[model samples]
Target: MSTMTVKRAELKPGEVLCSYCTARCCRYFALPIETPETWEDYDHMRWYVMHGSCAIFVDEDVWFLMVYGDCKYLLEDYRCGNYEDRPQICRTYTTDECEYDNDGTYDRLFETPEQIWEYAHAVLPPKKKKKKKKSATEVSHQKLPIVHI
Candidate 1:
């Protein structure tokens, strides 16, 4: 099927930009999530990506989990079916920072579980190596106790 796209540069003065959009914003929803610091936190993010067409992104130092699900009120014509009664969040969405105005790019975006895992491995500190246990005879003859600092 053919689709129409209007560039921000070509928009005429005072013209509504959303009318020319394919409802990009309506096709996805993003909610802020806790920043992944530890491997476990990133593992949770990886789990989210494994579920479906979801993405984890870091934008402006904030992390978010984006799910690709079209709004039920989205019409075939790329308009809101319930425009008048749309929710407050949708109503407050401005075209200024919309996907229509510019490309929707994040600081760091991960679409697959492997990407999150790779990122976690790259940033997180290496795991400490485990010390081997001493033999029973060696331990019994040791002069000093093993002290972990």
Candidate 2:
């Protein structure tokens, strides 16, 4: 919601969006994860977020694990050092989906392990407790077979 921002479709002639960007996309990478189906799955997500440099986010019903790290090829001037030899993924990127001027907040963001666990507790059913097993000394009563003193 930047007042001084212009959408891609509304950009004036001879304007490049990447020049105005601070290389936001180069600062992090996000990978989609399977929807958490069980408490253990949620716990796994919690573990991922606990690493300190990553987070869990839900956007448009899809879950993603966002890892924050600068690409080694990124230069100090916010430009890629290997632009000529960049990977195919970077070559295929387009500005249409860029978040340079747009607010890139996800629908739901979990930045801490406790936040993920709390979400699991809120959505998942209570964990079932296991029944305690009786010891051998607590066997059922029966006729005494011992005869020797």
Best by lDDT: 1
Tens-place lDDT digits, model 2, residues 14-87: 87777666788899999999999998899899889877999999999999999999999998777889999999
lDDT of 2 at 99: 73
Residue-level lDDT of model 1, residues 1-149, one tens digit each, is 12556677777899788878888999999999988888789889988988998999889999999999999988898888899999999888898878775667889999999999888889999857789999999988889867999
| Model 1 superposed RMSD (Cα) | 5.4
**Candidate 2 off by > 4 Å:** 1-10, 133-149
Task: Estimate TM-scores for all models.
Answer: 0.78, 0.82
Model 2 has a clash total of 0
Q: What is the lDDT of residue 11 in candidate 1?
A: 75
